[model samples]
Target: MAHPERDTDSAAGTGGDPGSWPARQAPGARDLAGLDARICRCRACPRLVEWREEAARTKRRAFADWDYWARPVPGFGPPDAAMAIVGLAPAAHGANRTGRMFTGDRSGDFLYAALYAVGLASQPTATHRGDGLELRGVRITAPVHCAPPANRPTPGERDTCRPWLARELTLLRPTLRSVVVLGAFGWQAVLPALAAAGWRVPRPRPVFAHGARTTLRAADGGAPLGLFGCYHVSQQNTFTGRLTPDMLAEVLRGAAEAAGLPVAHAD
Candidate 1:
């Protein structure tokens, strides 16, 4: 498979002033591919840049032979997706290593498994970007693109990264009909992006809860967007009974149906 990261480095340098790239580049992106290319090169947050690069250099023992991506991971899936899955951020050794959201991690294992079971993903596992995993009508993304220290990004960092999410939503506005926000962080972060992208978020902002559901009308009077909240597929939730296979499938199936996509019976 072609290693696109090698080419991305040179392009990133020419963009100028890493801290200002998102605000400057995001709105002007002509399409999803252009936006993703811009997202992959961001180095806006000094702390996150240092942390992601350090993790790549230190090299986790299990992946010692890997050429770590060590860059901001962009959203994965087709451009004209009807459903969107929003997560908090990439894992240090997961997406940070493979350069694909949810790849090389247990969280991805759980997520892809559920997606496959629901007939969205082409396969049940995502080991790398070139592994041939594909989503039929759904797109997966996150609030923060870089892996933060201890898997937590500061509020300032989240705000700084808001333009990317907002731009991504704007690009997907034509077909994006339903969203499954994983965890409270993603829920909190995505609401404003949705509003900024043309959806009219309800007053008294919606609270996050497992199985929580709401609808946001479009400012352009387009199709309404359905928002569903689900627990993060982190080990903490999956290892315990907090989030089960059936629970995840239920939410995904509902979202898929809401997006007017075909749903397969859960396995």
Candidate 2:
């Protein structure tokens, strides 16, 4: 069955400049809406499909009345965004339930608030899709679309999901100038994906750390893409003060500056 948000012909993901990308380069050949439609319908990984379906069927106690969005969650935000936020994956009860990235989760709670504070998101709370939460200069995506067991995906799963992110990044290349990576996992995942999508990642690879920043050039000699790292907005981090709200805001502010966005920060 087709998803409600699935407008396959909308084609928002393929608007970026082609530059020197070969005409036959297949990574980002399809438009975003088309890719989104394809993503939501995927059942390629049997384990993931089983897990996500089970999560949707066996509702969390707090969300017993909710109808879960058991499908893959696609990237969120406008196609021309200058900055992107790369996360680990969906939360079984959060995005897996709400059909939107970062919606209805504490991690999202920390993230959206920071984006809102920095003038990227129009509002802080991302409870569900069509909740009027809008992002101007930023978009968010994850390597794995489905929520995994204990929030950890296996190496095989990560590699299986790599092409989707690579294609998405290629499509976003024209306007995307910076990427704010959450956690070391996201940092590691995005580097190779961008490299595969024709971005020239630095040799020896840049190290990942809280507030670490690096740049990767396009293989076709286009503009560089800045990368800024932040601690994951997981409850484990926020509850322990390893990643405070102010700390998140600081990283986003720096990312916006790096992406050439015009947003002022009072933090």
Candidate 3:
């Protein structure tokens, strides 16, 4: 019933009539700005921000002191998405500089490729948020919104950022069905969120393994939201062959199937 990719609002009233009324354009800047405003000046962890700005300044020599968002990176996707992809955090030169998750850095290259392969991403390159790339049913976000030094976020920082994720997920409401966590940290963050939603932790304690899957009922007792885990796809994993393209694709295939959607392969 959810034609996520189509502008369904356009055809809803006319019953295949082309001239009844134009479909409502998807939510735009005002919608995203409201979400961005919440974290614009987040000073939740002073130490983290200090380190982040220092990293930004250090890299400014090459970046030419580029105006960086420096603020917390907000999630990008349809407001009524069913699946959310959680990453570790923004990269220093990537989202940290570009102000968009997974953009302007090498780290995003493979990730975007994978998204494109799966029919989620429309553009092959995620140069910036303005590149006009749009996700269908999938939303991409992070646990720690800001990029941390060496890509390691302190426990305190992750804890502080949890509320934002919780609030956004709560807003998505009935449409959210599953969350795909990129690494151990993201998996850990989701646990407290699930608890906050009143779902008890799994009896055996869900392990954060590649290809892992679990389901927790929403607070409303409707359908349970599925959770899937995948390798972080960091430099180490890819260089050491711990995670191969085929392996990542297979895990995503499993996740997509669990979401009851068709899997698309790259030609």
Of the candidates shown, which would achieve the greatest TM-score relative to the real structure? 1
What local distance difference test score does each model get? 0.91, 0.82, 0.71
* Residue 26's lDDT in candidate 3: 16
TM-score of each: 0.94, 0.89, 0.82
**Per-residue lDDT of candidate 1, residues 38-79 (tens digit):** 888788899999999999999889999999999999999999
lDDT of 2 by residue, 74-177 (tens): 89988888999999999999999999999999999989988888888899899998899999888899988888889998877777777778888878888989
Cα shift from native, residue 10, model 2 (Å): 21
RMSD of 2: 6.0
Q: Flag the better candidate by lDDT, 2 or 3.
A: 2
Number of clashing residue pairs, candidate 3 = 1
Candidate 2 accuracy as TM-score: 0.89
Number of colliding residue pairs in each model: 0, 1, 1
Worst 10 residues of 3 by lDDT: 20-29
Arrange candidates, best TM-score first: 1, 2, 3
- What is the Cα-based lDDT of residue 252 in candidate 3? 69
Over the full model, what C-alpha lDDT does candidate 1 score relative to the true structure?
0.91
Q: After superposing candidate 2, which stretches have Cα over 4 Å from the reference?
A: 1-29
